[model samples]
Target: MATLRVGRSVARWRVWSTSASVVVTEPDTLAVAREVVDAELSAVDRACSRFRADAELALAERAGRPVTVSPLLAELVGAALAAAERSGGDVDPTLGNDLARLGYDRDIAEVRPDGPAVPPVRRVTSWQDVSLAGRTLTVPPGVRLDLGATAKALTADRCAELVNERLGTGVLVELGGDIATAGPGPAGGWLIHVRDRPADPPATVRVTAGTAMATSSTASRSWRRGGRLLHHVLDPRTGMPSSRVWRSVSVCADRCVIANTHSTAALVRGAGAVTPLARAGVAARLVDNQGQVHVLGGWPS
Candidate 1:
């Protein structure tokens, strides 16, 4: 149990073999945090995890051509498919094999020294390659599904709701940079650090009560391939890492899932994503590759 006392209103708990931090105002909320975080992580691991054979995604993959899927995997795939359609195919979950071909098959820690050299670019199999018939999901031969972007955000949202329901109090859940907060904070809102580049100093943002925040950046969780930096934020159109038009995009919406939906789509949208995001009433702070910043609709000007 990795624990840290961060502030008066927040205590950070590292979980899920990844970081899962919870924020709460009540002193007694830690118990709920413990239960909710574990359950959420377990749910994500079972659903979309590529590394676990018993995982729902793995079973779907091995079941051989168009099989009934577990509810969790079906839900995640359905969400990804919807996002792909809504974002004009900006975000695609069928790029798992493409990502692996690009040397992201293993965790960042185990990546070989020469692994960064990206092979020749490949074609995106397209989200349409995935066929969902009710509770059944089928991927075209050679297609793999990855839900890193949506799954993490969904987990954060799920855990927050779980804590709120179980503890009968508000909760905040942060999975890496993606965060979702609920209930009342000490102030009128919850304070969080926002950054474009992961290494850069953080700028602060206050999320009003019951709202959640998520940040998606091309700069974080990236590796160098063929002397070029390859990031996990892939463009569905090109089947390659985004060109880094935006270093990061942080969004505060009513929920973590929605914030991630906007932020991930925003990263893929490049410069053209701003107006739509703003018109949609998303509060967004975007940092470009050149270090320029733009604040969208929800932020104070």
Candidate 2:
């Protein structure tokens, strides 16, 4: 008898990034796949989201004093600190309080600009200020850990890994537009959409094998505050929203966690970091605020 191959059809389910559709030949049950995606997204929300007060990250943020933490939290903070170093403090994880001081304490949906307020209001700087010894991460007397960049990607990467290990099949995990995939996809590659803004057209990135692609853009996650447009991607060097360098940067690499780290760092560093990224052998595409597209590194021209 021929190999008993269970015929399967494609099914889509929405969760983190609009929706995800997968076609599997081995898995005959649609309900099982949907359940896997649902469970994975729920884990991401519980571990890394800033909106939920009951999230693990929220608990860590409110730890107040030096306290022992789980390996997952430690991994997120460590990756964030490393990114801060790599970006030369351009991607600090200790800027949560600073973001709140600038009127982004709530979701961007509720934000509205008042009028011209201050030109150069400094917020927080230096992830070096957050000290982690063993499992106890000691935040400097008044500092707070924001791991917004790192935690989201970390959750994405982990969720992808979990599905692959448990289900023994291919998986694609996405948070917003950031994505991580494991095993093999339908076409032997994972197809991703890279959008400059919410309204702009999406460009495709074909990823093969175990890979991660992350994009950081200032379009959807920003609002006008004090007569100024402000976004969440804070520059640790200036302690404010990045100004008119690049509108967005999308990176494809081995890990979503590291890809997010680099993409956010590159945005903060502006156009200056393009050469370094190219030299480091990373794929990146940048869209400037003026609508100019810059394809650097391994990104297709």
Candidate 3:
């Protein structure tokens, strides 16, 4: 289903570069919101992109020493590390090389068209290998850092905060499948539709103000490598695509970062995710490989 936008006088901008959509409830503040949203994502990409040669993460890869990074990068690195710890290493920040070795060196959309073969590679660098002290970060010499799992979510959270607090209006920002809202929502709250695949039936739900939602899916961003199916979501332990027991997982939390962390970790954890998600008190929905659905932590059926 196409992304549905609600509310009156909202300016909607879709950024394909980041697969993001900026929706501001107050039409008058849309310009400011879009500017802030774009700036935030651009800054994040410049600071954290693994594909850019001049990105901070890229510079940290070759510095072979403590590299001074911007405060934003430092904060995001800390968030990624914390997410890794919270997810029990299920969502790692140091799998850049592991993913690259698996032939996911480029964006998943680009990698999917060729259907190249990639062999299973074991995770070599753990989050522990990347050391951060305030704004200084030290990565293992020759190792690459990929914050893809966490940076986007952090961007949404930051964008929402900036837009809401600065503009004094309610705003919703979605970076791909992760959605976050700030300030007071519309009368009935913000309505969002969730589905594992584009063709799948959607389940629409309204989020209260300040709520965030995220979905991680294996159904998308998949390719065939070495005659084997490969996906963007990888188990850091084996550096292989998850076994695909669960096709997708969606979670709602107070913050987009936490929600995204939970959803991505659920995809990596497969069938075992239910217990941990319940324990975390997250409202979530999981769809299995066989198309079975499971709801946990009071997720709406």
Candidate 4:
């Protein structure tokens, strides 16, 4: 883990193949804040990791019948299902098998950059097929659950809220660019440098306390297989990687999960995303495949 002191103390580490950063307004609370983030991250990884064979999700998938799960997993799954509904199936959690067939069965870092041709697998089951009653979850016979889309953002939201509640200090938790904050912010506000790719122009925006931001990118978590470039954001309809109409989409909302849901959906929606995103009434910035930037719903220019 790396730590930086700039009025506040920030700790950075790697988890679940992505970077995690935690910042606290009160420097003295930094250690305790880091502890809270670490504990929560570990818990989330255990509950929702798609790559871990011993994770709760794996066990539930292997059972083939309804199985009781932890409240955390239930909440995670619930959020994912809600996202799928909100996006009209553009953001789906039941594409796990489709993703695997396209060469994303393991951690992104472990995925082979070049592999044999694998045809796109049609979705046999949609998010509607998965059932969650109380804590019991049921995955259909051939369906697999993938929580990658929403679980990380939910963890960020959870960690920030938990840190602020327990430590009584303003905290910002960023997991792979899905950011959430709570408590009182620093002077002015929390300044976030928003950019999807390293070469893209950056914009610094201030977010007040208790708000969240999430960025979904086709540029990241991508690989080449059989001469075709593939990314993680899949269209549930075709069970294939979405065409790169937009390289990335960033959105701001009151909650990280909501913001992430919209951003990921925008990628799947492609050029047609503007009208729907505009209707949703959230501030968003979209970077197209040609690097043209489009701002909507009062997103700063």
Candidate 5:
């Protein structure tokens, strides 16, 4: 876990595979925020984690047929399928096997940095292959579903809402740059630093109330296998990491899931993303592989 003092009363935790920054108007409410945040994250991972054997996601995948799921997994899968629909298969949820074959079968920390690149599976699966109705989840044999793209953002949105509603205080949560805020923010709203990668220099934005922001990158969490470089963001069409066009993309929308959907799709769309994002009525900042940054749809001044 990591902490930093922002202004005076902000307390943050860099856990759950990313950073969670929480700030309260009253410093005394800090402990309450932590407890709520931890519970929310734990619930999400336990329900959806691809690596956890007990997770409903794993159980559903291994069933090789339709199976009943918990309410939590159903909602999470619903969100993922919604994302896939919104992005037109650009951000499919059925690429879990592709991710595994690409050497991301476990948590990033546990993945061997020196391992050889995993070749893509010959089987081609689409998000349409998986069906969800009411509380039942069905996946044909050999289909692997992973929600790494939108799950964390959804978690951040829920955490912020829970903390704000429970404590009646302002809450700002940044789960690895999937940011969300609820209730009332501080005097100048919430200050956000948008970066191409975690360590890069930032472009700051101030958000108020219900806005959520997310960044998707082809940079970090990457490893080389057999002389080829690979990172997380996979193109559903290719079943492989997207072609190196943009280094990163960031977007802001009404909710964290929406923000993540746009950001991930923008990265996959590469240079062609600007037009579509503008049409979607969302603000975006994209940095290409050549280090040139492009801004569209009025992404903060």
Candidate 6:
């Protein structure tokens, strides 16, 4: 399953405090594909970024009333809410304040690796508290929405679709490790290297066109506060970083948002995720805290 890079052109950049990459089968279309990806990323950031004061999410939060949002923001919010529902609240979007209280108030790049002890935080607000009707969004006063669980994956899906639609070329878009592919892939398929950290065991898997993959990890985007290591994935029920049952969870699905939704939810569900993931017919790879790997639902071994 080694990547066949011979005929592909790639462009990479940073966005939302993480890396972004775009790959195309046609070399001549790389520049235009990059432009499309950049534009899509910018639009997603403006609509969903929790760290940006000027982002639509921030403005909506400040309004303290029903706000008419752009279609893009509305879609992203709807996606987040839907993910929360599908995961049974395991992947929540109303944890923005919880994350900030845990010292993740800023971008991961800007967060101090060592910081003061996290202060006592209030109970997490449920995603049900947020409402979206048509293009109107309503966030309960004092509730904050964080779209981290689905926005990036949705952007990858959208970017790949847009590039393929507009340029008539096969495209793969990866924001961080969430990947989506459109149009026809290479002869074998698109090869993806799966690993949570550099020290973790890695595997290569091939996905055909129109397939998507996403990885959520407790080993990344982590920081130490008061000598306690905390990661970005939190259990909404407790408003605390999820237990390190699985260091990382990667899932493959027909869409990036679906893959990401399960991956993140798997992290929160810990060891109990195996049955549900398999029952749902999801192909998943889970790596434990001790680096042991488990494959489910016929994930490539």
Predictions in order: lDDT: 0.75, 0.69, 0.81, 0.88, 0.82, 0.89
Could you tell me how far off, in angstroms, the CA of residue 283 lies in candidate 4 after the best superposition?
0.3
Candidate closest to the true structure, highest lDDT: 6
Tell me which of candidates 3 and 4 scores higher on TM-score. 4
Ranking by lDDT: 6, 4, 5, 3, 1, 2
lDDT of 3 by residue, 114-178 (tens): 45565665456888888899988998887887787888888889999999999988888888788
Q: Which candidate do you rate higher for TM-score, 1 or 3? A: 3
Residue 193 CA displacement from its true place in model 3, Å? 1.0
In the predicted model 1, the residue pairs found to clash are 116-225
In the range 1-301, model 4's lDDT, one tens digit per residue, is 1112354488877878888888899989999999998999889889978888899988899899999999999999999999999999899999888889899999999999988877865556899999999999999887788998999999999999999999999989999989998999988788788886788767788778887999999999998889999999999999889989998999999999999999999999988999999999999999887788889898843
RMSD of each: 2.9, 5.2, 1.9, 2.0, 2.1, 1.7
Taking all chains together, the TM-score of candidate 4 against the true structure is 0.96
Worst 10 residues of 1 by lDDT: 1-10
For residues 1-301, write the lDDT of model 6, one tens digit per residue: 1133544498877878777888898889999999999988888888878888999889999999999999999999999999999999999999998899888999899998987787555574799889999999999998888899999999989999999999999988888899999999977888888876889989988788899999999999999999999999999988989999998999999999999999999999997999889888999999998898899888864
TM-score of each: 0.90, 0.84, 0.94, 0.96, 0.94, 0.96
Query: Clashing residue pairs, candidate 4?
Result: none
Residue pairs with colliding backbones in model 6 are: none
Model 3 Cα shift for residue 301 (angstroms): 6.8
Off by over 4 Å in 5: 1-8, 121-123, 198-201
Predicted structure 6: lDDT: 0.89
- lDDT string for model 2 (170-229, tens) is 766666666777766656465555775665545766667677878887765776656677
**Which portions of model 3 show Cα errors greater than 4 Å?**
1-3, 11-18
Model 3, residue 18: C-alpha shift (Å):
5.2
* lDDT value, residue 117 of candidate 5: 52
